[model samples]
Each structure stands twice: as C-alpha cells, then as structure tokens.
Target chain A: MGELYRLRRKIEQIIKDGNLDEHQTKGKITLECGLLLALINENTPDEVNALRKLKTAAEKLLGNF
Target chain B: MKMNSLKLKLISLVMACMLANALIIAWLLLDSFQREKNTLAWQALQGAQETYVHLEENCTRTLSATLAALLADEKIAALYQQRDRDKLYRYTAPLFEILKNDFQVTHWYFLEPETAAPAIAQKCFLRVHNAALYGDVVNRVTYKNAVQTKTFSSGKELGKTAFALRVVHPYYHQGTLIGYMELGQEIDEFLSTMQKMTGDAFALIIDKRYLDQTEWKNVRNRKNLPQNWDDMKDAVLINDVLPNKEITRFEGEIEKIPAAGQILEEKQLGKSLYMKGILPVYDAAQRKVGGILILHDITKINSNMKRTLLYSAVSIFVLTLVLGGLIVFVLNRLVFKRLDQMNQTAIRVVGGDYNTKIVPTADDELGQFETLFEQFRNVFVNAVSGIENAESKTIKTKRPVKKRKPRRKP
Candidate 1:
C-alpha cells in the first residue's frame, strides 16, 4: 500500500523470479537500504527520503530502478 | 585471481628479491673467476721469469768452470801470448766442440787486450765458433766491462742477430793482462727449455730499436725461417714455441711492461683458451730491450667456471620456485582461505540466517573477529524479533470490532 512496501515487493518478486538465494538477497537489500524488508507494511509512512532509499537499494540489488 | 591480489603481490616481491640476489651472486662469481684467471696468468709469468734466470745462472756457472779449466792449459796461454791465431784455433777447436756437446756451450771467443795503439786496434783475436769472422773489434758490453774492470764479467747480451748469455774473464798471463776469454750460449734455447719445463707457450720479442732489421732478416732467412720483422710494429719476434704465431701479437709498448711482469688479455684459439702475459727482458747493459710473451692454457678452468655458474643459476632458480610455491601454499592455508570463509559467513548473516553462528576456528586474529561478529549477529536477531513483536501487538490493538452494527439492528 505504501511506496516503500511497493518497492520492497518488487525486489522480492525479482529475487523469486531470478531464483536467487532468498535470505542472502533480502539481507543484501536490507544492508544497502538500512531498513528491514520483512517489516515494511501498509502503515509505513511513504517519506520522500525512505522512498528514494528503497528505490535506489532495489535498483542496486535487483535491477528494478 | 587478480594481479593486484595480496598473494600475487607478495610472491612478486619475493621473486624480485630472489632474482636480485641471484644476479648479485652471479656477478660475484664472475668477478672471482676473472681474478683467478688473472692470478694464474701472473703466476705463469713469474714462473717463466724465474726459470729463465735459473737457466742463465746455471749456464754462467758451467761456462765459467769450463773457461777456468781451459785456462789451466799452458799451450792455450802460450799460443795466445805469441799472437798465433791458427795455433790457438787448432788448439781450442776440439775443446770447443767438446764443450758444446757436453755443456751446451755455443760461442767461444779469444780477444786481445784493449790498447791505445791504432796498429793493433783489432781486439777480436779468435772466435772458435766462427773461425772466418775474426780480426774485428770486440765492442760488446761484457767485453768492455771485463776490460774496464780487469775482472770477471758475465751477463746476457744482445748481439746483431741473437741473444747470448756470455761470461767473460779477463785473461792474465804471468802478471800481465793478455786479453779476454769469453764463453756464451744462445738464449733461444732458454725459451724452448722454459716451454718444456712449464708446459706453456713462450715468445721472445726484441724491440726494433735495439735490433738491426736487416740482420734479423738475414738470420731468419739463413735459418730457413719466415722473416718476422714486419709481423709486428716496433718489435720483432725472435723465437717462439707457440703452436700459432698469432698468439704472440702485441701492440703495446714493450718498454712499458713492468720489470716483474704484466698480465695480458686472455685469448681464445679455436677450442682452447689462453692467458697471455709479458715479462721484460733486460740485456747486459740493463736496458729493457724486449719482452717474453707467455701463454698459459686455461680452457679447462674456464669451462669449469662456466659450468659452476650454470649450476648456481639453476640451483637458485629451482630454490626460488620451491620457496615461492611454499609461500603461496602457506598464505592460502593460513590467511586467504580463512578470510574467504569469513566473507561467506558475513553474507549469509546479512541474508537473515542468524541461526548459522560464526564459530571461530582458532584463537588468532581472524578468530577474534569471528567471535565479535557472532555476538553482533545475536544482538541483531534479538532486536529484529523485538520489532516484529511490537508490530504484531500494534496490529492486534488496531483491529475493528466485527458485526457490532448488525447486532444492534436485531
């Protein structure tokens, strides 16, 4: 529902489609974005900085920029 | 692996050090070998000079004793006092032949005393070796020294065409000086004898300044030998025992050669290597008139040195290879491989596999890092779990009551 959650979902789908190691891929994205992907939900505020960080991390980790 | 890797860099540094050391060792070995060659050449020169002196001394003693024995003959003194050249020759010719055959004596001379009178200026009374070449003035240094001192004189003197070790004794009969009796042997035989004694080649070079080119050419021609006056500049090769005459070629000033000797450049003749040198040859007047070129064979030693250097190079190369391999193996086993393991463990922990603990394999530095990372992973897992629980409780509290409006309508 939130922009950050949407970016997180896109990263998850890319990892699944690529059949990459799930924990390793998510952990890489978490370290790069400095946020936990599993905790991202609809209640999360779609702050401009958070959204930008999520998009950049997803782009770097999953090529989903 | 990348070239910039630590392992490759360390190996490159080690290899560079080893290469530098090998080059230094090779340079030292070559320098030592060169010094050894020069020393051998110098020793050969010294040995040749000593042999020449010893032979000359022996010849002087033998000729002195023979002349002493000849002077005991009353008839020899009587014939010389009467100035009878034919009787003196007839008397001493047989004795001269015996002396030549027995003691290697080659020249026998009888001379008249120096006089200021012009009518008797011919000082050469009789030459037993050359009966036809008489009535000539004896102007040799040995003759002059003997006449001037009125005593025994002996030294090596260079003649018009040859070098002879002559021993001249002032002849005195009944308290009056009669003349000089001299005995000599050609010094050409000294070169051959020295060659035989030392198993090295020798060449006698007389400077053109001290020699008559025409006389040298004539003697060479008479001996059926090649005229060698043009073979060299400023000097002529009088005699040589070298298999190849080209080895005697020298271009430097003969007078500049040191008195003790000088080592020359090494020469390669076909399959053989030779160390050449020069020893100054002095005449009775103590003039440095020539040099004796000495060539010593050093092929075996040179080949041995090269073989030793090859062996050393191969040994160093093999040692470097073995050492490099061992270093790489130890580095990989102790550092790179363990660091790679730590890298993989960190990636898995970042992927949320917190249960997989980073167990330290040793008590070393890497092990200490692993223990610290494991403790951090535990804290991160606990913190994430606490966040998840807080989020679940907030969701439950925010849930809306179900069907409350429907119950009110009923």
Candidate 2:
C-alpha cells in the first residue's frame, strides 16, 4: 500500500511539472488515477470490487505505456 | 410504484366511496319524501271526510232542537186540533216570522198525517224573500224501533227550484197523532260553514233533471259534450265555495258522478293537487238524489316536502365532496407526504449519497419501511468499506511480489 502511494505521488508530481493540463493524453491518465485513488480511499466494498477490475485495466495500460 | 401513481389510486378509491355514499343517501331521501307526500295526501282526504261527517251531525242536532221547541207550543197543538186554517194562520204568522229570523229556516210546511203516508202536504210557508209554495209533499220518514229524527234530503221535484235540509216532526194531540210539520233550511249556508271549517272547496250538485236548461236535461243522451263533461254525467252543480280563479267555468261538473261515495282520481292544476270525494245525498226514500263533492288541495305540503328533500340531497352531495377533499388532503399529509420524502431520500442514496437519511413519521407500516431503509444504508456502507479494505491489501501485496524479479529461467 505504501509503495503504491509513493508511485501515485511521483506520477502526480510529473504531471504538475509538465503542466499536464496542456497535454491531452497525460492529463487524461492523471485524472483517471486521481479518481481511482479517491475511490480506494472511500473503500466501499462495491468500490473495492470495482478497483479489482480497474487493476486488470491498469496492468494492460502499463504494458501499452 | 411511483408515489404519484399511488396517490392517484388512493384518491380515486376515496372519491368512489364518497360518490356511492352520496347516491345511496340521495335515493333514501327521495324515497322518504315520496312516503311523506303520500301520507300527507291520505291525511288530507281523511280530514275532509271527517269534516263532512261532523257537519252533518251538527246540522241534525240544531234542526232537532228547533223542531222540538216548535212542537211543544200548546197554541200550535190547539190550532191544529180545532182544524181552523184561518185561526192557525193568524196565530202562526208572527211566530213563524220570529222563528225564521232566528233559525234561518227558509221554508215551513204543515201536513196531515195519513194512513197512506206519514205526512200529506197541506200548506207551505216561506220567508218574505220566497213566495209561498203550494202542494210540496213531505213524505220522508225512516221508521225505527222507536220514532227517531233523521235528516231527509229530497231531490228537486216538478216546479221545485231550490235544494234544502228538510226535517219532519210528527205532532200528537193527547194520544193520537194529528199532523206533522216539515222545516227547510237553504243548503248554501251549510256548504259555506263546511268550507270554512275544513279549509276545502265544497259543491252541491243536483240531478241534471233539476236543471232548467234544455241542453243539460238531455246531458246523458248528448254525444258532443266537452272533454271535461265525460266525468259529469247526470249531475249539475247547484253551488260551490271554490275560489273564483280556480273555478273553471266547468264548476257545473263537480258532483256529476252516477255512483255514490266514489273517490275520484286526483287531478293536478299547475302546482296544486286536487282530490275530489263524492258523497251521495239520498232522498227520504233512500233514493240517490245528488252528491256533495269535496275538493281538497294537498299540494302545499307535497311541495314543501320535495323542497326539503332536494335541499337535503344537495347538502349531502356538497358535504360528501368536502369530506372527500378533506380525505385527500389528509392522505397527502399523512401518507403521500412521508412517502415522497422517503422517495427523495432513496433517490439520493441511489446516487451514491450514503448520508441521505429517511425519518419515520409514525409507528405504522411506513415507519417500519424507514427503519428497514436505514438498516440497508448501514449495511451497504459497511459492505463498501469491506470491499475497499480487501482490494487494497490484495493489490499492495501482489504488486510487491511482482516487483521481486523472477530468475531468468526462461
């Protein structure tokens, strides 16, 4: 959980430094990650199941990126 | 179901019940009004008949007293015993005048009692207004176990113009009957008195044979009489106390029925209902002479009852509508209002607002729904939390294990 938080923060910093709003692709990824983390913080059982599905999607995105 | 639909269904049920109740009440009210009208009509008929009976009794009593007083006079008996016509006339003229002035008797007849008839008419005396009538017989008598005075109503004879209430008294000198006297009173005053007492219209009708007109003499044989004349066969009206405006010139047809004691069918004149009752006036020989027809108006009571019933029906309809509206308002407040609130809260909950709360308004069924909804929300929030915890722990450990590189063991 700590490692995932560190990874998420690094991605957030890169997006801020790059002014990701000016870029479409990176801004889209940053927005999705932020929404995913908010859902996780809420930690509803339904959301957790949704997050498990999202993990598979993230793994696929990792290979593509 | 949607709250709006539920509300419409409930209101429809209430309105239907109210309409059914109003219709039932209105029907009952109309039925009661009809019964009341019939009762009023019946009472009016009974009252008219009873009044006629009481009038007849009073007339008989008064006539009896007057005749008794006249017969008790010794001079009258002595003049009759001596068979002195001139002396009797001289002695009775002034006395008859006094009696006529006080008693309102219009005709007096002196008769000799005969074996063939109880009284054979000898001389006729009248008030100053009427000419002295001659040779009118007074043979009306009803014999009982004892001599009893009875009212004798004779129909018109040849040359007789007026109908009267006739009373006959047999006079006795010592132990043998000498002669009988007959007293006559005009029928108009009796009719007037009865009309006043009963508050009804009265008419005395004579046989058409008594009518002077040639057209009425052959009334039964005539083919083309007026439509109104169909019920007035063999009779002619002598007098009536009906209001002038209400008296159709056909007033002559009032008592013109052949049968005795026949209650005619009711007739309606505008808003007024008229019922006619025919009572036969019999001749001393028990022959049907004429009839007394009483017309009673029972319209006022009938109209009043109908008006009251209409007002009551209208009031009930208005009250039902008001009560129905009140029921709708109460349902909106007590049931639909709470249901709407619950619906709004449920919508918010579905929209992921877990904090949305439903409060119970009563300890009834809806309140139970609120409690169940609250429990569902708690369980849902807890379940969401459990899912998040399990996913987070699983993802963190799997990622670390993946990071530990597998030995390049292709």
Candidate 3:
C-alpha cells in the first residue's frame, strides 16, 4: 500500500512537471494507479460474468504477443 | 542483464576499421623507405665508378709526361755510361727535380737489373733508406715479375697516389730504352697531388701488395681488415673485406672507412674514419689489379639524418596525441556515454513507465532511433489507456440500424 502511494505520488509529480495543475488530480491519476493495484493485488474474481466465453476471449487477446 | 548485441558490435566494428587504416598507412611508408634506399645505393655506386675513371686518366698522364722527359734528358743518358755511385747520383738530380717539381712526385727510384738480391740505386738517401726496410724485393732488380706487375698496374695507377708507385718502362740511354726507370711516389703526397684531378677527393692508390705493412697501412683510418686476412698474403682487402667475386666491381658507402676521398684499409695509418667511395683499380687488360678507393666522412650526414628522424618521431607523436584526444572526445559524445544514458532510459520504460522517453544529443542513427521509440511510446500509452478504460466499462443496449431503402421506394 505504501509502494502504491509512492507510485501515485510519482505520477502526480510527472503531470505537475509537465505544467499541469499541481493541486488537482482530475480523478484520473490516482484512479488509474489504484485500479491497476487492485487488479495486481486481487486473489480471485469477486463476481462471475454472464458471458464467461466472451470474457475468456478478451483475456486471450490481451495476453497474445 | 539484457545486453544489446547490436550496439556492442557497432562499436567493435568502428574500432577495427580505424586500426586497419593506421596499419595500412604505416606499411605503405615503410615500403616507400625500402624502395628509396635500394635506388640510393645503386646511384651511389654508379657515381663512384665515374670518379674512378677520372682519377686513372689524370695520374697516368702526369707520370707519362715526366717519364717521357726523363727519357729525352741528356743528364739521365749518363747513367748508362758512368755506372759510379757519385756520378749516378749527380745524373739523377735533375730527373728527381723534374719528377718532384713538374710531376709533383713525392719520391721516385731507379731500379737496377734482375738479380737474387736486387740492387736498389736511388737518387735520394731518404727514399732509398725507406725502401731498404722492405728489402730488395721492393727494388725488383730485373725480376720479370716486376715488369709484369708494373705493366699490369700502369693504367690504374694514373688516377691515384700511394706510398709506393712504380712504373717500369724500358730504360732508354739515347734513342732506345736500355734498362728501366722504376719510380715510386709517397702515398700521402700522391693523394694530395691527385686531388687536383680528383676534385678535392684524395685518391688512395691501393695495390693488392703489402698494404697492411708500412706507409699504405698508415694512410687509412679504419678498423679490422676482414676477419679472415693473412699478413703475408697479397690480397686486395679494402675496408676490411675482399672484393666480392660475384660483383664485377665494388663501389659504395664504406661501412667503416669514413672519408670524403677514396677509402683504403690501411690499418697501419692508425686513424679511424668512414670512406664513401671504394673503387677497384684495374690493369690495362681490364683485370682488377688493385683498388682506387675514395672516402667521404658521413659523420655529419649521419648526425643530421638522426636529428631529422628524431624530429619526425616527435611530430608523429604530437599528431597521434591530438588525433587520439579528438577520437576519445568524439566517441564519448557519440557512442559510450550516450548509449549508457539511453540504456538506463530503456530500463525505466520496460518497468511500465509508458511515458518514458530518452533524450538524444546526436542526429545520427541512434538519435533517430530514440525519436522513433519516443513516438511509439506515446502511441502505445494512448492505446493502452483507451483499451483499459473501454474494457473496464460495458456499453448500454442500442437500437439496430433501420433499412431506409423501402421508405425511399414507397
């Protein structure tokens, strides 16, 4: 969790250094960081999808070289 | 530790090409120096031969004229009649004067008839005492070999000066040559006298005869006559080595005898110097009877050449230092340090920093690559973010597209 905060802070600094608003996050930076951390930290799926076959096809496409 | 093979190979290739260029240039210069040296040696030999021919002509003409005058003289005719020591001595005075003044001869002799112990009758006590040491064989009373040796040497002796020079012409009383006028001039004075015709070069008249013995030995300033030399043997050893049988004549810079004039290996001279031109003296029939050696002291030339080589080395060293410094600087800016920074940036990009970029200082291939990679990174970031956002949401149900063709037809 602390590493995640550090990563979030680094991203915010980059945006600020790029001449963006240093105070406002636009709910994008922390959201993207937090969501990716959840995907990495999650042990299993919380809810089952109705179209499991479609979800399986989407995962296969993302993992392919 | 993912190593980039491509960049490493490129660096090695550039270094190999530079080394190859330097090696080729050095080889070319060495080849040029070898070629120049061969040509220079050949030209020097040719020039020495020309000088030899000139020496022969000048000395022979002088001796011939003096001998002709001695033959015609009424005082010299009296030697055949008086046969007394005092009378012969008086008769030989003007002949000596003619040889000394007109011919500029250092010494001359009147050799007696052939006998086991050859009787040496001479005009000057100084000249006679000197020859007496070498014994009567030097006088050559009426030895037929004396005549042959003199006849054989006549042509070659003209151009040079020596401690001993003898010309055997049939001694004429009145109109006919009766006995012989065996004359010798000292080698040193002969060298000086011949200098007129030899162009400041002292011609050392060296017969294969007793050169290592007395006066001739003292004239040359050099070292160890060829390693294999016999003291009593009559061999033409010039500058230590015998003339090569393979070479028709030997003429070039002396390895030891350093002189501007002809160099003779007269070890008796007790002086050490270098001789430039060493020529073979030949008989009338073109037989190499002896050598007319010329000496040129190369001390000055050798010293100057050494200085030139030193300067050349310094110049090459300075140039290489400057070039190497430039190469190091260029390599640092263009290759090593640049690649190192680029490598670190690439590592960061791989660690999921999608906006990561490398700054390129050069406009070369590597710089262009970095620019391209930066562009790809931007496109990649946009695609990933868009895909992730789209994947995380589901679109609501929408009405299907209606066919407008039937309405248009109605």
Q: Is the docking of candidate 1 incorrect, acceptable, medium or high quality?
A: medium
Candidate 3 lDDT, B215-254, residue by residue in tens = 3444443443333233224443333221222121333322
* Model 2 TM-score on a 0 to 1 scale: 0.61
Query: Which sections of candidate 1 miss by over 4 Å?
Result: A6-65, B115-122, B356-410
Give the per-residue lDDT of model 1 (tens digit) for B1-410. 79898877887887788789878988998899999888888888889989989988888888888888776678899998888889889988998888888878899998877762565553777899999888788888898898888777889888888888999988877877777899999888888899889999999988889888888888888989987888888888888899798898988898899999998888999999999899999999999999999999999999999999899889988987898788878878877887777677666666667677777878998889878988987887888778877987887787776764555554
List of chain A TM-scores, every candidate: 0.88, 0.39, 0.34
Error of 3 at A30 (Å): 20
lDDT of model number 3: 0.45
User: Quick one: best TM-score, which candidate?
Assistant: 1
Superposed on the true chain A, the predicted chain A of model 1 yields a TM-score of 0.88
lDDT of 2 by residue, B347-372 (tens): 44433355767777788887898789
Question: Candidate 2 — which pairs collide?
Answer: A44-B384, A44-B385, A45-B383, A45-B384, A45-B385, A45-B387
In candidate 3, stretches whose alpha carbon ends up further than 4 angstroms from where it belongs are A1-65, B1-53, B78-86, B101-163, B168-182, B188-296, B328-345, B356-372, B390-410
Task: Find the 10 residues in a row with the least total lDDT in model 1 chain B.
Answer: B401-410
How does model 1 fare in lDDT?
0.84
